[model samples]
Structures are given as C-alpha cells and as structure tokens.
Target chain A: MKWKEKDAAMYLAEKEYVDTAVIPLMPVTAGKDMQDVVKSGEFIRYFTEYLERQYAGRVYLFPAFTYIKTKQVPEEQLKHWQELLREEGFNHFLFITSDASWRRTSADSFGELFWIPAFSVENMEVQELAKTMEQQVQQLVPLMMDMWQSEEK
Target chain B: MSEKNHRVSRRQFLTYTLTGVGGFMAAGMLAPMVRMALDPALEASGGAEFVSVGLSEDDLSEEPQRVDFNVEIVDGWYTSEQSRSAWVFLYEGEILALSPTCTHLGCTVNFGTNEEYPDQFFCPCHFGRFERDGTNIPGTPPTRPLDVYDVEVRDGMIYLGQINQRG
Candidate 1:
C-alpha cells in the first residue's frame, strides 16, 4: 500500500495482513556531484515504485527518507523513522537504496538493508527502462522471500 | 404591389445569408471542441481485451506455472503498462488460467511454495491456501476461490483476458 489517504485507511483496516514496510533511502547532495545524486535518486524512486506495485498486498511503501549526505548523519535520522514504524507494528523493515554507504549501519533488530548499485538511466527509451528495472527487481524478489522464510524458523 | 413585397431587398438578403453562414461557422468550431471534451465518456466501454502472455499453450502441464504478462490499463486520462501474473496449466485436458491474487488481502499467492500445502497455492503474507483447482480451502483467510481468467489460444500462443470472479 502507498502513503495515500485511501491506502492509509485501507492499511488501518487490514493492518495484520500488511506487516512489512519498505522505505527508500535517498541522499541529497549539492556540489560537483549534484547531477549524479539526482540521477541516483531518480533511479531509486522508480525502483521502489515498481517494487511496491508487485507486493502491494503485504507491504506498505513509506515515503523516501531523504537526508543530506554532508550535513547530517543518516544512521541517527533513519533510526528515528524505524522506531516509529516499529511502533506502528511493522514486522519486517526493508530499506532499499542506491547509496552504498548504508551498508555500514549496524543491522537493527528487525530492519534489513539492501544497497544496490545505482544504474544511471539517463537516456534510455521508456520500454527499455521498464524491462531493465523489471529484471533487476526480479532478482531482489528471492532475497525478500528468503527474509520471510528465515523468520519462519 | 404583391410582387414588390415578395422580392427580397438587398439588405434583407444580406442579413439572411450572413446569419446562416455565421451559424455554420460557429457550429464547425464547436463540434470538435465538444467531442474532445466528451472523448472519454464517448469511448466504447469494451470488455477487457486479451493480451499475449508470451507462453506457449503446448508447454502447459498439470503442474501450474506462473506466467508474467503486461497489460495496458487506462485510468481516467492516464494510461500505463502494468505487469501482472497468472498461473497457467492444463486442467481436465483443457488450458486453465487462474489469477494469483489472494482474495482476502490482495497478496500474491505462489503455487506449491509451502511444504505443508504442497500442490496448492500458498499466500506468504497470511496462511491463505487454495487448492490446485483454485478453490479456497476451508479455514483459510481467503473467503472466495481464486479468480479465473478468460483464456484464448491462437497459433500455439496463449492469451489471457480479464479475470472472472468465482463464488
């Protein structure tokens, strides 16, 4: 479910079924790397949107957690969000990002971090971009399934 | 005296012809604009069209296989291509296609994914289970059976249409 008003109401009603929260971690930086930062953010946004549609039944897609790369510490800020989501009863926390630095954060009790290399989709055709993202998301599906399978034991 | 009244004066003739031409011009400009405004409502409310799922009918077996396909959905003025999946297999010597969406909470169900429910569709989100024929097993979360898709085969390829809800 998305963070829309209608989906929010639906989430409240079916809170038990939707136990997973997927958050996108986006880095905002301004400098010589502004273009690259924007590109990566765009890629992550598209990737998460596609991912949400596939697993919308059981996952709540939260808005992107944006933090300035140079001005703030992501770990502290991200923990605050995770704590609030945990309080809301999310069983699994999946953080998806193109920022590799997130891997340094120590794993939380219930949260899992996925750091994928940012694919710069600067000049691709629409059809090609969709096909590429679909294939990439397919590879992540198994990893997510494993996450759920591990919890069963 | 009667002929003089019947003959049209130049001023009267110009007034009549100009009014007639002006009405035609106004209608000509308004017709397309009106049609454009009503284009959405005027469109045919057709049934769901069959989309090729890129699967061969010959490959289907008794074991249900997940086939991912794309559908073009138009909502209001926005049109998008969405990826959807269905379980396709041979049932009773005929091709059968079933939607994998769990009826209870809309989770995607997998075929034979759970060890306990081998040969049945299993919902990972909650423990919803459906038999091989898409029947929702009693005591499962899903209240209704899995939806069946209208299947079409042409030139050895399989195409699936809109889902038909089952009681």
Candidate 2:
C-alpha cells in the first residue's frame, strides 16, 4: 500500500489496498518569511493535501511519518547524533515523528542559509527543504526495506 | 362570472397560497432529517455490514488455531483483528471460545505448560491455574472461570459478542 500527504485517518484503508506506492511529497516552505522557522504546520498541511489529491484512487494515503528539525544540522553532524540509533537498532524503519522546529535538508555545510540556522541572520526557503527531502527518501528506503524483511524472518 | 362564488378575497387567496407553499417547504426541510435519523438503523440490519466467520458450531480440536477475520467498520475504514494464537479443544461438537484472560488477576494465561502441570492454563500472576474445562483449581488464586464469548450462528457463520463468564 502507498501513503501520500492526503488524510491522517486514511491509514486504515490504505493498509488494505494492495497495489499502491506511498508518495511523500517533496517538502516546500510556505513563504520566504524569516520571522520563524518556516512554519512546519503550513508546510505539512499542504504537503498532506498534495499526497491525497495526487494519489486518491491509485493508492491509500497514510499519515505523514514526519521528522522536523529546528536547525539544519549538516548530514555529517546528524550522523553523529543518531549514531546510537543504528548501534542499538532503533531504526525500525517504521513511520517516525520529530518535534524539531526546523525543516530537513542534506547540506554538508550548514552555513547561515543551511536552515533556520543557529543564531544568525538567515531564513530557510522551500528549495532547500525540498532538496533535503529528496535525498532523505532515497537514502532511507533501502534501510527501511531491510528492517521490514528482518521482522518477517 | 358563474364561478364567482368559488373565488375568495385577495387576502384570503394570498394566505391560502402562502400556506400551501409553507407546507411544501416544511416537508422538504424535514425529509432530510427523517432520512438521517433512520439511515443508521437500516445499515445496521443490512447483512453486508459485518460478515461473521463460522466458528460456533464447529467441533473444537485439541490444537492451537489462528482464526483470521475482517470487518468493514466505517464507510472508509476496514478494521481487522486476528487471533495470533487461539487454543481449541473439543466439547461434544460445541466449539468454545477459550480466551487467554487469566482468572486470578486478568493477566494473560499461558498455554505453554511445565512438567508439573501437564494440561492446564498457567497464569503467571499469583500462580493461578485452571483446568482444561476452565475450572479454577482449588488453592489457586483464581476464584472464577474464564470468560466465554457469546456465540451466534447466522447462515453457517459465527458472530461473537461480549465474553460472558461461566457462573
């Protein structure tokens, strides 16, 4: 079954659908405002709708298994923070949620524009969030499949 | 002018027309409310609402069985819960729903037996034990029998309701 940004309650019906591909829309920030970390709320709201409208009959929509970050920590730094997750096998590859106020990205160098950066004069944009999401899905899918198969065995 | 007696004053005609229109509007407004009130009852009795798996009349065998069943709960949501492990034992061609709820403290009873207890449901909580027929052993912490599911057969299908305890 597949899940798009549609509706949260559709997870029940989506699980039954046999032939559907889960599509998590690429993230885009609401606007160019630097006032606060681009509102995760608005971004996810649209993203959620995008999934539902795009994949209505083709597949069912599962709730967004989302992760938000208040600051764009470069991919290098994130590795260290989640080192224990891999060591202890906490990465079940299931849907996950994060309360970080920042949008996600794959920047190796987290300059002021890296994210709602740490104590600086920079506000993140949609392009960067989308780019990060693109990379994350690609890298995470294989890891997720590995976890799923192990459970069956 | 021969039908003049059948005619009425302008105000009287206006009142009659308004009343007829008002009655039609009132019926239209109440039509939706009437349908909404009765639609749920209609869906409840419909046979397609929830299909039951046949389990009540079948003879229970002394074996572990996993019964799978699915139900369409809401219009868009199809919910299903299965017995990961269900124990079945024969009782004169009547199949019993042997739930794993422990009688002592409602903990799950384990069918895995030790050498000491050859055939009994062992409750880890308070060291309670029950016989195959679900009778609590004397000197055990359990004081009641395990709950049983209300079994109903409709067209060779078994529908189970709230679990009732054997008094």
Candidate 3:
C-alpha cells in the first residue's frame, strides 16, 4: 500500500495486517546545477515503488521525506516520525535513499537507514536501468528479511 | 364532415398522454437496476483471461522456477498493468504455477530458502512456511494453502489464468 487516498483507505481497514512502513528519504538541492541530486530523487522513487510492489499487502510505502541537501540531516524530525509511525501501529520502519550523507547520522534515533550510492540515470539505456534497479532490490531483500525475522523473535 | 372524426375527448387525451409519459419514466428508473442484475452474465468469464508467462514447456523442471509476467488489471474505472510473480514447476506430469504470496499476511515467499526445511516454501515475515505442494505447515501462521494459478499450455507456451485457492 502507498500513501495515496485509495491505498490508505484499504490500509486503515486492514491496519493489523500491514505492519511495515517504508519511507523514501529524498534530498532536494535548490540550484539548477544539481542535476545529480534530482536524479537521485527519481532513483529513490523507483526503488521504493519496487519494494512496495514486492511486499504490497504487508508494507505501507509512505510519501518521501524531502529535505534540503546542504543542511544537516534532520535527526529531530526523523525521531518524531519514528514515534508517530510507532503510535500508528507500524512495528517495522525501513528508510531507503541514495543519499550518502545519512551514513554520518546516528541510526539509533530512527529506523534502519539504507544509504545506497547515488548513480546518474540520465542517458542510460532501458535494459541497463532495469538491471541497476534489480541489483538494488536484491541487496535490500535480505536486509528486509533479517529485519522481519528479528521482529519475530 | 362528421364532428366526431377529428375531435378527441379531454379525458381520453389526458389518459393517453399520461400513460406514455409514465411508461418512459418507469423504464428510465429501471434501466440501471436491470443492467446491474444482468452484469455478471455480460462480463467475460474468469477463464477467458490468460496472461502469457513467457515460459515454454521446456523451461519447467522438477524444481520451482520463479516467473514474472505483467497482466492488465481493471479495478472499477481504473485500468493498469501489474507485474505478478509465480513459482512454476512440473509435478507428476502436470504444470503447476503457485503464487509466491504467502497465505499468511501476504508476504512474498521464497522456495527452498530455509536450510532446515530445504524443500518447503518459507516466508521471511513471521517465519511462516509451506510444504512443497503449497500446503501450510502444521501450526504455522497460515491456515490455508498457497494459491495456485490456472495453467494452460498453448503452442508450447505456458499461459496462466486466475489464482485459485486450493481445497
């Protein structure tokens, strides 16, 4: 399920079944020269959508949390989001993005942050683009499995 | 000329006009209900929709192979293409295509992923597991068996229909 009206209605009806929340942490730069930053946003969207489809009924794909790239990581805001989602009955939270700066931020305050290396998708062929996305999904699948298993214990 | 030939009584004219107008109004009100009652008959039967899985007869093995395909899904007025994945295999000379979605909470299951249970389907979520034939292991979270897709072989290619729940 996604953060759209239709999916949210269904999620509310079956809130017990959907236990995981996947949020895309996107960084937006306010300059025209930051094409790579913009591309990273597109890549994150594509990647999160794949995750949502793979685990459609169990996972809720929340809207992207966009922040200014030049500023420090929003640790306070992220902690608030974690508390809010936990109150809403989401037992698992997976934050995915291609922004490398998040690695410096402490993961103790928020959910597991998966910081994938950014890549430029401009001028890439369709087949190559798909292969790149597939590789990222493969990497994330085992991590997700581990998270679910830990929760079961 | 007879005066009665061209003359209509007021009562007669009123009755004729009212009947015609009432019939039209009644038909208009009943049209939607009539169509709704017959809608199922007008809809194409579930068997008619067979999506190609792009796998041939030769591709099947004793082991389950993951196959992905896209199908056109219609929900009310919205139409979209959704990619679906299934685990396909040949068992006892019959082509079997099982939906990877675990019967317990709808998580995608993996074939032979558990080291302890090498031949069974394992769900990463909640540690749910199913037997080789998609039956939920006893005392597991899933009370029902994993769904199997209706299969058809045409011109050496395999096409899958709707996912059917097992008894």
Candidate 4:
C-alpha cells in the first residue's frame, strides 16, 4: 500500500498531472453488524479533516468518496480485510478482488474474489476518463499544494 | 410640527410610550427566533455525504499503486458533477484510500507497468510523489506519498470520506 501511494504520486508528478481523489464507491462494507455505515461516515470525516489540515488547503476530499453505495464483497472477505489491515497497511481505501484469497465465508458460502477495482478505466475508457481527471487536477493542484514553504521528504 | 404633529396630544403621548415598550418586547421575543431560522443555513454550508470507493477486500493487492472511484456530486440548488478519482496504496485485505492528485503540478499520475519491474505510478506533471502518503520507493519522481483517506465499514457496506492529503 505504501509503495502504491508513492508510486501513484510519482506518476502524477512526472506527468505533471493532478486529478480528483475519489473515495471509491462502497459495494461491500467491513463491519460486525449489518448497519454500521454511520461509523463509516465518521471515519471518512476524520480523514477529510486530516487531509485538509495536513495539506493546509491545497486539496479537498471530494464528497462522493464518503458515500456508502453498495454491498458487493462477501462477508468472509471483509473479515480478511480487517485482519489484513493489521498485517498489511492500506492507508484507508476498501479493496477486494477474486485474486486476494481469503479463508472465511459469507452466508454459508465460500467463494473466491471476482474483482479488485483500482484501475481507472485506464483501459475501460481512457480518453473520457483522462479528460475528467485532468480537469480535477487543474482545479485541485493549486488547492492541494499550498505547502510551498515546507521542506520535502 | 404640522397637523399630524399637533395631534400628538395626551393620549398620543401614552401610545408612544407603550409603543416603545412593545418594540422592546418584540425584539426580546425575536432574537432566538432569528437564530433558529439561520442555524440550518449555517450548518448546510459544511458538507454532505462521504466518498465510498467500491473495492472488495480480496482484490486489494500487496503491491502499492493507484486506485480510482467514480460518483455523482450535488451542489447547492440544481448543480451537480460526476466525479472520477484515483488514490495510491498497497492492499492486504485492508482498505487504504490515497489521493492521486500530485500536490505540485496538475496532472493525473499514469500507472506504468512492465513485465520486468513491478508496476509503478508515474506522474507526467513535474515528478512529485509523497504529495499524499502511503508507501515510498527509491528513485521515484513523486516526493510525497499519495494522500490517505479515512475508511469505515457499516452494515456490510463501505463508506469513504475526505481525501487524506498528508497521510
């Protein structure tokens, strides 16, 4: 996860590109109960405040990133996620796919993952997607990078 | 001091005195009412909803890279925008959302994949990583990690919120 974030930022920096950072639509949630979305909202809020403060106003967490849209991943996978968070570090994005094998079950059924969605239609729909992303970059670059006075890591 | 002013007699004096008292009474009663009316307006300016990226727990790979999400945004009256975004992270069944927007130049980071080297996120902009934060690699153009996002699970559904710019 650390590598990915850094890698992603590098790619953008080289390309001199910036885009809107979207919170992926939630298809499946990770929780012990059936209705724990309120907690989820809080989590997003906390992160947003953190980003805004840390960046000192160069960017904003777009509103859509915090919406609970659906429930797609099975229960077992969600449990695996909780366990994985402790083991592997995922900064704060919900991820799943048929490839990320897990050893649990949801609704008395065991199944492999079907997909891990992170690729930006980079292949699914490149031209339109790139245009949309560029617009956001133009808008947020000025907003996210006010940290000019601060030194780099 | 015309006809109307001249008519201000004894009865009128008392009426004016009572009017002054009544004005004070009305203001006393209206202050809280005004606050209540504007309270919601003040609050509405804050925000609405979170950004939930639709990724399954299993699909999160151990490799760190950029992720994406698309959603509908409603602003003010009838205004709205369909937004697409990307973040960086390495997944191990955990949810980690990172902002892909480079803090330096404005450009979308393009993911460069090769059979020899592991997949890499490259920004064509001005080579700035670590603008957010996740995992760092040597020799990368990005000086900062992709921004981190706060994630939570509820009722078997996921909810995302604000981009973590410095995480």
Candidate 5:
C-alpha cells in the first residue's frame, strides 16, 4: 500500500497483512551540492516507488521524511517517527536513502537504513531507468526477506 | 418564357432565401454541439492492449521466470510509462503467463522461493501459496486462483494483454 487515500482504506481494513512501513529519507540542501541532492532524491523516490509496487501487500510506503542536510543525523526526530509508526502497528521499518551521510552515521537505531550510492539518472531514458531499478530491486528483495526471516526467529 | 411562367414573387423569394439561410445557420450551430455531446462515445474505449514482454519461446522452461515489460499508460491528459512484470513459463507444452499479483493483498509472489513451498508460487507477505498452475492452495490468504494473462505469440515473441480472473 502507498500513502494514498484509497490505499489507506485498504490498509486499515487489512492492517495485519501490511506490516512493513517504508520511508524514503530525502535531504534538501541549497548548498553547492544542490544538484547532487536533487539527483539522489529523485533516485530514492523512484527506487522506493518500485519497491512498494513489488511488495504492495505487505509494505505501506510513507511519504518521504525530508530534512535539511546537516553534519549530524537528526537522531531524535528519526526516533520519534519510528515510534509513531511502530505504535501505528507497523512491525517492520525500512528507511531507504541515497545520501552517503546516512551511512556514515549509525542511523540503524532508527530502522533498517538502506543506503545506496547515488547515480545520475537525469539523462537516462525511461526504459533504461526501469532496467536499472529492476536490477537493484532484485538485490533488495533478498535483504527484505532476510529481515522478515530474522525477526521471525 | 419558362422563368416568367414560373415567376417567383418577391415575398416568395424572400421566404425561400430566409428559410435556406436559416437552415444552414442552424445546422452550423448544432453540428458542434452534437459532436461535443457525443464526444465521449466517439472516444475509443479504454481497454488493455497487448504489449511485447521481450521474451521468446526459447526463454521459457518448466520453471517460471519473471519477465518485465514497459507499458504506456494514459491517464486523462498525462501520459507515462509503467513497468510491469509477470511470471512466464511453459505449462504442458504451451506458453503460460500469470500475473504476479497475489489475490489476497496484492503482493508479488515468487516461484520456488521458500523451501517449504517448493513447486509453488509463494507470497512473502502472509505465506500465501498457489500451485504450479496458480490455483490458490487451501487455507492460503488468496480466495481465488491467480489471474491469467491473455497471451498471444507473434513471430515467436510473447505478448501479454489484460488479465482475466481465473474463475
């Protein structure tokens, strides 16, 4: 399910089946790295959208948690979001981002932080973008399965 | 002589010209209104069309494989391309394509993924299982069989159309 009104109704009706909450963490910066920030945000948006489609039954894709790029990770705000989602009955939390700063910081406490190297997709054709994301999603599926498996134990 | 014999009175000429011009003006004004009223009917009904999945007969085997394809979707005035996937394999010497969407909660099901659910499509969401032929296993979340795509083979290439619910 997605962060849409129709999907919200379905999610409420079948909350048990939809246990995973996916949030794309995007950084907004007006610095010298503005282009890079936009590129990574674009990639993360598309990546999470595809991931939600693949696992729509189980994943409730939340709107991206956007924050200003900073040296220190916003640990408190991130934890608050996680707590709210957990209280809302989402058992698994997956946070995907293309920002390297997230990987540098120990943000695993927030949730499963999925950090991918940012790739420029401004010039990529639609067909090529789909192929690239499909390949990456193939690798991501196993990671999610592992998360689900480990939690079961 | 004939023109004089069939002489048209000034009043008759005026009436005839007025009726002729008025009829032409009325038709011109109503033509656009009629077309606008029937515009919806004139439009081609929105139906799913066959799209090539970039797979040939040689790619199929007994084991089902995921095939991805791009479809052009038009919603209102916006046009976009969407990527969709299906599981394709050879079933009883015939090409078979099944939609990956699980009937229970719309999760993508994979074939031969879990060791416990071997030889079946397994939904990771709720452990829903379907048989090789996409029949929902008893006690699974799915209440019905997996949807079957209308398959067409042209030039040895596989093209899939709209999905039909397996009754």
Candidate 6:
C-alpha cells in the first residue's frame, strides 16, 4: 500500500496486515548546481515504487522526506516522523535513497538506512534506465530480506 | 340526428380504454424478465482471454523459467496495461504455469534461491518456501499453494490465462 488517500483508507481498515514502512529520503539542494540532487530524487522514486509493487500488501510506501543536503541534515525531523509511524503500528522502517552523505549523518535513529551511490540519469535511454533499475532491485532484495528475517527473530 | 351519430357506445369506449391500460401493465411486468434473459449475453464470458508470454515448448524444461507478459485491465473508465509474470515449466509431459506472487505477503518469489532448498520456490519477504509443484512447505508463512495460471498451447507458442487458486 502507498501513502495515497485510497490506499490509506484501506490500510486503516486492515492495519494489522501492513507492518513495514518505506520512506524515500530525498535530498533537495538549493541554489548552486541543483541538477544532480533532482536526478537522485527521481531515481529514489522509481526504486521505491518498484519495492512497493513487489510487496504491496505488506509494505507501506510513504511519501518522500525532502531535506536540504547543503544545509544541516534534518535528523530531528526524521526521528519525529519515525515515531509517528511507529505509533501507527509500523514495526519496520526502511529508508532508501541515492544520497551518500546521509550515511555520515544518519545514525540509524529512524530505521535501516539504504544508501546507494548517485549516478547521472540524464540523457539515458529507456532500456538502459530500466536495466539499471533492475540491477538496483536485485541488490536491494537480499538486504531487505535479511532485515525482515532479523526482525522476526 | 348529428348528436346521436357522433356519440360513442359505452361498451366500445370501455373496451378500448381497458385494452390500452392492460397492455401497458403487461409490458411493464415483462420488462425485467426480458432484461434478465439477455443479461448473460451482454456480459463478458467466463472463459478468460489468453495472452502469449513469448515462451515456446522447446524453452520449457524441468526447471521453471520466469516469463513476463502484459495484461490489459479495464477498470470502469480507466484502461491500462499491467505486466504480470509466471513460472513456467514442463512436468510429466504437461505444462505448468504458476504465478510468481507469493501466497503469504504478495512478494515475488524466486526459483532455486535458497541453498537449503535447491529446487523450491523461495520468497525473500518472509522466508516462505514452496515445493517444485508450488505447494507451500509445512511451517512456512504461506498457508496455501501458489496460484496456477490456465495454460494453452496454440501453434508453437505458450499462452496463459487467469490465475486460479489451488483447491
């Protein structure tokens, strides 16, 4: 399920089924050369959507948490968001992003942080973009499964 | 003389009025029955339309191969194409096409992924495993067997239809 209105309504009625929440930690840079940051945001959206489609009933794909990369990392804001979702019965929180800087600042306070190196998606062909997305999905699946199994234990 | 000729008989007027009202009442009573009789003809048939997954008989072996195809969905006013996948293999001279979606949590299952179970379908989401025939292993998260799709072989191509839950 997604964070949209229709899916949220269904999630409320069947809250017991959805235990995992996926949040995309998107970095939005202001002023100087914002092109790469925007591209990373696009990639994160595509990857998260693929994850949601694979595990629709069990995972809730939340809206992206946009934070300024050039400025201070909004750790407190993310912690607050995590607490809110936890109260709403989300046990597993997976934060996916292409921003590497998050690895330095994020303390795993919210949940598991999956950071992949950002790449230039500009001027890429459709087939090439799909191939790259497939590769990323293949890599992330094992990591996601490990987290889920550890939580069960 | 003009008044007498112009005046209609009471019997004739009553017969005409009764026929008109009774015919309308009879037609109203039969309308719903007629609609019910024609309803099945208007609806799409129960037989599902098969879609080619680009897999041939020669490609199928003892091992399952993942085949993806697009299925057109018409939901009211919105029409869109959605990609669906299945695991196809040949067993005992018969073709079996199983849905890849896990029965436990709807995650896509991989074939021969787990080292412990070399020939079973493994779901990474909850560690669910299915036997070679798509039956859920005992003590696994999945309660039922993986769904199987209706398969048809036309000419030299393999076609798949709606997925049916195991009985």
The CA lDDT of each predicted structure is 0.85, 0.45, 0.83, 0.43, 0.87, 0.83
- DockQ for the candidates, in order: 0.35, 0.02, 0.30, 0.03, 0.67, 0.35
The most accurate candidate by TM-score is 5
Clashes of each: 0, 7, 0, 99, 0, 0
Q: Write the per-residue lDDT of candidate 1 for residues B1-167, one digit (tens) a residue.
A: 76578689878999999999999999999999999999989886646899998888778899999887778889779998777789999999999899988888777788998998798999877779999999999998899999999999989999999899999
Q: Give, for candidate 2 chain A, the lowest lDDT window spanning 10 residues.
A: A111-120
Interface RMSD of each: 2.9, 21.4, 3.7, 9.5, 1.4, 3.3
Measured by lDDT, the strongest candidate is 5
- lDDT string for model 3 (A75-136, tens) is 77887888899999998888898877778887534687888876677775544555567688
Q: After superposition, how far is residue A78 of candidate 5 from its true place, in Å?
A: 0.5
For model 2, residues B6-30, the per-residue Cα lDDT tens digits are 6687789999999999999999999
Distance (Å) between predicted and true CA of B114, model 6? Answer: 2.2
Task: Flag regions of model 1 displaced more than 4 Å.
Answer: A106-110, A121-153, B1-46
- Per-residue lDDT of B1-167 in model 6, one digit per residue for the tens? 76568567778889999999999999999999999999989887655689999988888998899887777888779986666789999877899999998887677888998999989999866678999999999998899999999999999799999999994
Give the range where candidate 3 chain B is weakest over 10 consecutive residues by summed lDDT: B1-10
Candidate 6: list runs displaced more than 4 Å. A4-18, A28-38, A68-70, A107-109, A118-131, B1-48, B74-78
Root-mean-square deviation of each candidate, in angstroms?
Answer: 5.2, 16.8, 6.6, 20.1, 3.3, 6.7
Give the DockQ-based CAPRI class for model 1.
acceptable
Where's the lowest-lDDT run of ten residues in candidate 6 chain B?
Answer: B1-10
- Candidate 6 lDDT, A32-124, residue by residue in tens: 658878877888887888788778767899999988786567777888889999998998888888877677775376698888876766775
TM-scores of chain A, one for each prediction: 0.91, 0.29, 0.90, 0.27, 0.93, 0.88
Global CA lDDT of candidate 5, please? 0.87
Poorest 10 consecutive residues of model 4 chain B by lDDT?
A: B124-133
